[model samples]
Target: MELESPQRRSTMRDAPWWRPLGPRAPWVAALLMCAVLMSAALFIRSTALESSALVARGMANVIMVAGFEAFRDADGLPDQAALDAFLASHREGGLRYVAVLEEAQPLVSAGAGKVGTRDIQDGSPLRVEGARARLIHRIRRPRPVLGPLTLEETRAMTSVGDVQEPRKPLRMVYEFEPLTALELESRSQRLLGVAVASCVGILALAFAFSRSLAQREALAEELERGRRLAALGTMSAVLAHELRNPLASLKGHAQLLAERVESDTLLAPKAGRVVSEAVRLEQLMNDLLGFVASGELRRVDADPNDVLRAAVETTGSSRVEVRYLPSRTPWPLDAGRLQQALENVLRNAVQASPEGRPVEASVEHQDRSLVFTVKDHGPGIASGEEERIFEPFVTGRLRGVGLGLAITRRIVELHGGSVIARSHAGGGAEFRLIVPARGV
Candidate 1:
């Protein structure tokens, strides 16, 4: 069975719900979330401002009405001394001036500034207006009785003004200056800054959470792939073991048949073909078994150049060009297993190169690790199949069972090394094998 490629596996799996927006999802989500928070902050600020304004107006009206009631006598007529005393007590309480208007004429005035009849008549109840410095005022008409004044009583008394005409109902006007626009603006800006800062902090936290979740998801996926590969290795080992005996018996019978067949007869060629096919099958079984098998390594300190030369000689290829950069210190490795792994890679490189084109092999030390590189001049590995080619039974060629690279990888891994394949800059495939200088 073919193992699934990493790309195919990822594509087949369903992505997390939050991943639909792709890599920039965090930034996009953060911006949109912050925008919504800012809108809410603005909305809340507007609502709070409106509420505060309403409360201020209501309180001011209450204060003015109370002052008017305090100045009135039981007969419901304003007393001059009482009005003066009430104004004096609340002079510093944001109350600029207070006046009593009778029939569009000022009757009793207290505090600063002279009051005009038109000013009292034109002023509405609890009105505020300003550009730079805000002015708020409350105009109230005092009731004849004072306590729990009703609208019906106010209208009845005003309607009978010509008959009784007791004193024209008093229009109590109170004016005060509130906060300036610049001060209020500065306060609002501070609130907005705090809201913006809060939003940024929340976005940062959300981004961190998303990053952590992505890392855990990736780790889980890697673990799952490892499990699948382990199970596959187990199954392949069992199958290879079962087929070994029968494959060996078949090869032996084919060899006996070839020996018995006469060389001059037509049966000889057919028997020879049978023996060759049987040999191929045996080799295929051995390759599969070797890939699934685990073994101990006999590590020893050896020169990397000697290993590379040995691998090149094993391939028996005259078309290979070696560029060996000798290391100062010898590398510790399993000589036999390392040579086998190198031979497999070198042979593949030699096979991949055109007849005249030289296969380039190189050895170098980098960052405490020995690096071996083999480059072929033939058609490079197909795009998106670099990692898949190392899987068992996966092949780009038509010939033998595709277990050479797989077995090579197993051997190198046993020695705690890594093998990677890529397309070379000069138009071919390149394989790099990196091994630690000290054996694991």
Candidate 2:
């Protein structure tokens, strides 16, 4: 059977759409949030600026129209002085140029001088460049009022250039910077700050939400693993209790039959096979109990070298080689449990090695931890199976259940340590049991 990483399996079986992103979910969400929020801010800023420009344009037209009517109702022609005064009064409103022209020649003008005849001949009513704007408006004479003329009105009409002077199709040209004229610099700055602040705040919130979701999923998976292990332990206890007596009786009868039928060759071999199978079953039962055992450690000050020696002796493999580096300092550990863990790993290495090949073992102090290593001259663990082989009932061998490494890992972790398996560079599988050298 094929096995995969627990996280990948969990994600495939029952995870949210974003569960596959794992630790990167927050970053991904933050990027997407930034893109959307910045886009919105830019759109709003552009819309507001457009609206402001239109309002400024309308106000300029109103002021210019009022001035034009005033010049028309005066007693004499509006000279350059009057036009200059009109422009200066409205300078704060962004008015840079004002002129009254007849047939492309300036009759009166102020601010940046009169428009060029060539520019006027071009016939474009309005021209805009960056923040500056120019508008050309044709002026119309006010019609005579229906009531009897007042003394001031009659006197004004009787001037040298009378109301009868042929209406000169007069044109007024204006140039100004609308945005700067209306003093929108501060308002634009405030809008920019608000936009930037809004985008950052929203991105932060999105990142937080993503992190919280990932954490919640991780907790749920952890709880599920606890439940499965709890149920397995309960079932293993019940089966061990119920099967022990019958298994013992069967092994006893098989061994007695083998002894009595020694002279009967055929019957003797059959009985021998039965006893061997029973022994194997007994070993299987022992391994099962060891795997489902609790993780509580009983710690004591013990020498690691002594523990390694004991494990090698108990394994009883003549081909096992030791590379012992004795440590002068004693380490805190549960000697019996640690010995058992080492023996399990050593026995597996011995079993996997070729006939007459040696299984190597070593122990040494590195930094703040004690490390025990085992290497077997056998076909190494398959690719991608290094971590999976540590899971309960996951064996790479044709014989025996796969609980040795799992038990070893559990015992090591109880000491606040870890176990890792990898293929040796030369040719074999290597296992390391690294544990803290000091008391927990």
Candidate 3:
């Protein structure tokens, strides 16, 4: 029935993998949300860029086709002046160069620099070259022909409308400059950077919020625990008061009965049992009263060694071995209250030891505080019951009501002291009580 350490218990609660992440859970969720948003933004950006590229290419084709049609005559021969004007109008629209080819040769060209020589065939449609985009259209027309007997041919041709032969197709090749892939990629990267920065901000804010929330929860839990303790104290006080009068009357009657039946052996034994039980009940009631009362110390300058010796003698246990190391100055404490606390602890240690085993009690001064220790060479306190032993009505012993150590703790705490229980390295239970030299 040993009580667990507060730190150990808290560690156990957070031991599960998922439980350890509770405080950080909000931050994790926020980061995930940011990731989702960033992914969506990038997806939309990529889609828009792709669609824009398609639309730009479509619009370029339309502009080139319209300009080519406007320059051509009814005979399907391009006007040089009209073609020059069309090229000038689109010069600022990334149109680097324009060329009209006839029979795989340049017929007319307009640009800041010479257009490169490239293989062009009739009926070749739109195509892309390095740093340039091109559209090609073929134009066909009738060609005039002369036969032998020029005067007769002229007269026969004059009688008919006109005699014509098929001519070679003319290839209208229009080349324009287009945006580079590197420039588009740079723009997309800038957008991605902005999204990433926004996500980082979101995560940071989430972590801060989570930290504040965890602190609030801890404070609330502490307040709740204090409220419970205060309520328990009130209830114990009422019960102790209600039971004390009846217990005192019972003890008095039992004592009188034991005296009256002194001569009859059987009757005397029965009366003795009743008296002993009453005494035990009275002691239990006293322990309850002490535990519930608000501890108010009557402070005086006293020697810690003297207090230890007095407590050991009060326990009336011959099995206790006393050790004391005196300090230069006496400490301020409520001597009676401290003696009672020590007596309770010393009694527990002595009771826990076997007949032959000695309980060790020691007192010393360290770090301006009186340090009292009691240890028993017996089965140590059960694991996980070290702290619980100090709690009211919690004990490892079968017959113990468990209020002794609880009362001891209250008295020690009232004097601004602390008590801790642990298993000694040599295999026994050890209790250490530390009281500050200055009174509370």
- Determine which window of 10 residues in candidate 3 has minimal summed lDDT: 114-123
- Misplaced by over 4 Å in model 2 are 1-46, 49-53, 56-60, 63-67, 70-84, 96-175, 179-200, 262-264, 353-358, 377-384, 424-428
RMSD of each: 11.3, 9.0, 10.9
Predicted model with the maximum TM-score: 2
lDDT (10s digit) by residue, model 3, range 335-384: 88899899899888888888899999998877878789999988998898
Please name the candidate that would achieve the greatest lDDT relative to the true structure: 2
Q: Rank the candidates by TM-score, best first.
A: 2, 1, 3
**How does each model score on TM-score?**
0.63, 0.70, 0.59
lDDT of each: 0.74, 0.81, 0.77
Return the TM-score for candidate 2, rounded to 2 decimals. Answer: 0.70
TM-score of 1: 0.63
Output the better candidate (1/3) by TM-score: 1
